[model samples]
Target: MLRITATATISLTVGAILATAGFLWADRAFPPPLPARLEASTEVLDRDGLLLRAFATPQGRWRLRTDLASVDPKLIEMLITYEDKRFRQHRGVDAFAILRAGWQLVSNGRIVSGGSTVSMQLARLMEPRDARSLGAKFRQIFRALQLERRLTKDEILTRYLTLAPYGGNLEGVRAAALAYFGKEPKRLSVSETALLVALPQLPERRRPDRNVEGARAARDRVLNRMVSAGLLSEREAARAAAEAIPERRLALPAYAPHLAETALRNAPSATAHRLTISRPVQSGLEAVALNAATRLGPKLSVAMVMADARTGEILGSVGSADFFSTGRAGWIDMTRIVRSPGSTLKPFIYGLAMEQGLVAQETLVEDRPSDFSGYRPRNFDMRYQGDVSVRQALQMSLNVPAITLLDAVGPARLAARFRRAGVMPQLPPGESPGLAIGLGGVGLSLRDLVQLYTGLADGGRAHLLRDGTELIEPSTASTDVLEPQAAWQIADILSGVKPPHGATQRGIAYKTGTSYGYRDAWSIGFDGRHVLGVWVGRADGGAVAGLAGYVAAAPILFEAFARSGLALQPMRRPPAGAIRARRADLPVTLARFAPGADGLTAAPNAPSEPPPQIIFPPAGAHIDLAEGTAAPLAMKLQGGRAPFRWLANGKAIAGLHRTRTATWQPDGAGYSTLTVVDAAGRAASVSIFVE
Candidate 1:
């Protein structure tokens, strides 16, 4: 009998050893697949990892990417304590939990509590079944055991946090936090963390948006469980439980919508895209554009782009006034669309002329009417200031003076210079470059305009704007758009221009441009560190009345600069070669600009004699004048030149002629005089009073 018993014991021990070895081999060979929930929605983030935009996943759900480190520590502690107390001790499945579950089922004649560990719950979420049956539970247990052999504790938790559904279309803790609290998971308060940790157990039944009372109850249950498990103090748990439940879901951050689309195009396969944009700056500029658009009336769109001048990093871009307003064609990204640039190119023409020694800031240039190959360019106001200093002519945006320079600088050469600056303006089809290009003849985009201005800020060197993704580092190859002296001279001239109404002096060099027929208006400006451009107009190329750049766009530009929260750094000082002397102090050839008979390059010499001078209404002459019964006064001139600028008091007298005499009509009885400035910078003024 003893021998027989020994034999049976040996057989039983051998069978047990074989069974154990088989199980170990199976665990090593066929571990559970880490849930195949890899399809995540594309997320666009700002420079600091702040969410800028998010898209729905292929399955029409918001399953944002999440990890253990990105969640609040308090939330993770509560989650593990309430869901799986032995999560750290067990490999995956807890035998004690399964036994307790079975005992409860047997005692109640039905399933009462799920005694499922977090890992098992994760497995069920990975391979979700329609019905909660015994078969599904068994499968979850098997998958959990397999997962234990393949992943670490942290890895399992991350999978659960990422895949767990949190009601409706929202999945994952990050998505839940953003939807319920309008904040990131990492910034959750104690109450917020408890609510987030409680959602996945019964998402639909406890969804705060759908059932506030149910959500509160579930959150309280979590708090009570945490207290019982010693994970939280009773007082703290009660306080958290008392916190109000969120009753509504919030939309995610949606700034830089167009930029987000661009990012997706740049990296279509990426699950998350990071851009070089500042959240605060972008948000502020969006508001600026929207408010400006509303005030500018219907069908008017506003676009802006701001960048780091030195590094060429695009900081913010507002594609349109409102992304959803069809009335303004807001769907179109105005920053990228080409439109006539008006007088924006005049500054570059002046810069080129300065670089070539063709003109100096104070050098006198004729602003009178002139014809260049039948071009006959006229000023915006249809009146001339005669011979004005280059500085005044540029500040006033005199078209005749700009065309004269462009005629001398050759449109082809200007186009080449623009190419060197890393942008190519679009000339009208079937047309060669011409003087018209200097004044709104060519098409350019807001981005291109901003880039050129940034080049000026960088001392004439043009750099490619950085996209913030770092997928492609900025190139070292830079183009010299202008000489340092020329850039400084242009910046100096523009900086002195008067700011638009309601704007403070910001020490910024800026220029405004109005396209033909009021189709496009632009304001491009820069200080030492940043460059910004603003464009306002209709997207369909239709003209909008009263769309002058100085009045419409400059105000928006100044407001944007103020809202950006960036320091107003002063522009670079004049370089060594820059000239700072008066017209008379300059070299004889550079002192005065007298266009040649051909109406192109500077003449060989200034006129031999001074320009004609007015000699009428001798000093302090008072003549009887009335508003309705005022006789036209005859103004006489002495030797100088014709087509002179005759100002009655401080207003211009219309029409240009070589006649030695001119007529003026007084508006009312007041102190007034006739002041004439000839084409040679020679001026004579007489004081008179109308009684």
Candidate 2:
């Protein structure tokens, strides 16, 4: 009998050893397929780390990247207490819990509570199983043991937090929180914690949007379990249970849609992109664009961009009034679309001329009908201000004067300057730069125009605009767009332009432009620190009747500045050698802009009478007129036919006089123009500032 018992014991021990070796070999050979690398939605964030937009995962799941540090501690505690009581102490499986579950199942003749630890649940999530048989349970146990051996307690928990489902197409705690509570999972109330902890058990069935009562019951059960486990007090649990569950999921944040898309395209492999945009500024500008577009009637779209002149960082960029609107072709990014930029290019033309010492702010330039070779530019009003100071012509956006300057400066030189500023205006193929370019003949985007103006705002150094996503680092390299004095002169003239009707003047120096046929309307402005550009038109390049830049875009520009949530920075003080002088104060050559020999000249064969020339308070002079008192200014002229008519700023100062001198009372303390025209049509003008 002893020999028989010994043989049985030896056989049993041998069998047990073989069984253990087989289990170990199977666990190693068929290890659970842990996700090689979890995929999460890519996010586009603003400078402040706020979400601008998010793209779904390849599987079309809203699985936001999450970690233990970003989750609420209370939610973690409640989750462990409710899902797996022995979660902290267990290596993979809880033997005592398993035994208790078995005993309860046997006694009750049905399944009781689950004995799976959090690690086991994580293993099951990694390698999902459809069957609930003994074999699947044993496989889960083996996978759980493998996971505990390879991962730490925190790693296991974090993976579970990320992979656990909360509802249809929503995975991970961050996504769940954003959808249900409309916020991040960084802070959660007792009610919110309970709801999040309970959703993972049966996400689909307990989805609050589909079955509110079921979700509420599950949440209450979690609260009760937490109370029993000492994680929450009875009163706190009762209060949490009384809270209502969200009946529907909320949409995630979506801002700067066009910019976000551009960022993604620039960095297709990056999981998160950070741009130099301000969320508040973007939000405000978007609202302004939408409301403006709605009021402007159908098919009209608006695009805007605001940037920091000092750093070239794009603060706000609105591609269209609405990205989803079908009528406006909203998906097109109008800020980058090349279109005819009307009088917008005039400032740059004038700037180049001033830099070359061709004209001064007060110098006279003829705005009468004149042919530039073959191109004859006309005023927007189709009328002429025959003889006007350079300042008056620019402020009025007169085309004739601008074309004359362009002709003298040479169109190719102007195009070269644009290239230096990193903007290349599109000219017709095989065609060289022409005088017509001065009057919206070249193609440029709103962004191109804004970039050029950045030089005017930042003392002649044009900063390269960036929205992050460039492979190369931001360059500190400065491109000279204009001389400091010239830029300052341009800014001064633009600032004096009156704001559009009903728009408040915010001390911004701005220029307005209207493309030929009224196809595009543009307004670009700058303060001491910021520059903003606005475009209004149809995306298809179709003309819109009555679309004058001053009437259509100037108001929007002012409104954008007001709603941009930025303080109005004052313009910079004039640089050295930059001064506003009357024509009398200017040099004899610069006293009047003579478009050179290549430009407009006296009619061929017309007998010449010496032109009327202002001689007193000579061009660019400053006179002291007593303040708050009527003080007459003494003016004189020479070499003109008798019966000369005098004018001040386009208004008649006195009737034709044979005498070369006259006196006129000043109206205000500022710059004024004095002109004398002879009976033979010869004219001479001087610019004077009254103190």
Candidate 3:
């Protein structure tokens, strides 16, 4: 009988050994399930790892990446003390805690405390169970064992911290901390840490957004447990429990939304993307844009881009005034939209002219009524400054002189120069190069404008803007769009231009432009360190009356610089060949621009074009004057020739010269016949009675 029993025991032991070997072999042969913890929420962060934007995970939860190093260490201590006291010593499950729980259940005839370790909880979170049954518990045990064999203690703890539930759609400690305290998890108060440690246990029941009283109770429980475990003094626990609980969730940081979206799309496989944006600067500029757009008219939008000129890194980009407003079509990124740049390109024309030694700052240029072929360019105010210095003409943005210089430099060459600097201005389809391009005839986005201006800021060398990618070294080749001397000259000229009120002391070189028909307004400027561009107008191509760049956009530009938090570096010193001398000191060839020299007038002995016709206040019409003595009647003309002369009631208007529009002050209650005659003696007449 003894021999038979020994044989049976040996057989049973061998069978158990075989089963153990089979299980071990299976664990080695088959791969464990890929942890759901790996599917982290995609995030867009600033240069310092501060959240700029975050996207929901594929499961529609906020499961951000979290580890022990990033989390508050106090919270970790509280978590282990409350959840699993023997967590470090146990392999996967706490045998002592399980036995204690079973003993309490049997003695009390009901369940008391759960014995699952932190590892077991993580396993359940990774592979969720539909039912709370013995089968689910067994599955969790198996997963816990697998995790213990595959991961380190910190790894298991990090998975718990990241995957633990913290109320609706929030599945991580960092998300909980941010949602509750509106800050990061790296720094937390005792009360906040206690609440965070308790939420994952019964997240839905104690969600602060939905159940404030329950949340407070749960937090107090954590504090009490902490005191009992000797981790916290009773007085400290009581003080912590008295802290207020957040009743509402807070929104995550949403700066640089367009940039965040672009980065995410560019790197779709990445779980997180780090940008070069500065959070403080970005936030401040976003506020500036929002406030500016509100002050501007309805249906109008604002877009701004600011970059580091020295490194060519895009620091801040406000894609639009509002990203969620459908009324303004704010979802469209205006920074990338191509529209007429207006007079913004004028500086480049002067810069190119300077590079060719064709003009100096003090060179005399005629701003009188001029025409190149059929393209008659006039100043913005439709009046001439007549023979002003090049600096004055450029500062006042006189169109005639700019076009003349562009005529000398050739528009094709200017276009090619910009292309070489990584800015491609879009001309009208099938249109040949013309002098009108010097007067806002071509198309460009704010981004392109910033690129060109940054070149001037970088001493004539243009570097491509960095978009959170690898840094590209600037080239020192002759491929620079402008020579150092020319760039310094342009920068100096712009720095002398007047700033908007309340911003006169800012040492920035800025230029403003109003597109034809008031469709687009632009303000582009740069200091020694940074380049900024602003655009304001309707999203759809429609004219907004009284929309001029200086009035609509320049204010925002100045305000952006003031709020950008970057110290304005002084512009570089003038390079060789950059002179600030008077007109007489310039070379004779560059001192004075002759009439026909720039193709701005009819060739000598050429046939004269017809004189202009007065189109407004038609002949024999009676008119009642509007209120206000300053309200001069607007006189318009058509088919004008060079230097068209205007006469109201046979008196030549003093400031009237070659242009389409002329404002004439009417004598009170009189008959008036307005006649405009060209320099070539071609004339037309309009008569009206003023009441």
User: Would you list the C-alpha lDDT of every candidate in the order shown?
Assistant: 0.82, 0.85, 0.82
Best-fitting candidate, scored by TM-score: 1
Worst 10 residues of 1 by lDDT: 597-606
The C-alpha local distance difference test score for the whole of candidate 3 amounts to 0.82
* Residue 206 displacement (Å), model 1: 1.2
lDDT of 1 at 359: 71
Q: What TM-score, computed on C-alpha atoms, does each candidate reach?
A: 0.82, 0.79, 0.80
The per-prediction CA RMSD against the true structure, in angstroms, equals 14.4, 9.6, 16.5
Candidate 1 — which residues are off by over 4 angstroms?
Answer: 1-31, 35-37, 104-112, 466-476, 577-579, 597-691
lDDT of 3 by residue, 1-691 (tens): 9999999999999999998787678667764575655788899999888988889898799888897889989989999999998889888988888889889989999888888999899989988888788899877777787788899899999988988999999988988888889888889999999899889888999999999999999889889988888999998988998889998999877888888888877778888888889898899889999999899867999999998887777889898999998878888989989999999999889987665445668878888786677888877898998888888988999998898889877999988898998877787789866788888788888888888888889888887776683334444342367766678888889998898766656999999999999999999999998999999999997899999998999999999998999888988976532457766544334456554443333234543454456678776677778766678888888775667656553344665366788887876664455666554444566656677
Query: Which runs of model 3 end up more than 4 angstroms from their true locations?
Result: 1-32, 233-239, 469-479, 583-591, 595-691
Candidate 1 structure, TM-score to reference: 0.82
Candidate 1 lDDT by residue in tens digits, 238-313:
8887789999999878889888887887778888888888888898899999999999987999999999888778
Clashing pairs in 3: 342-440
> Per TM-score, what order, best first?
1, 3, 2
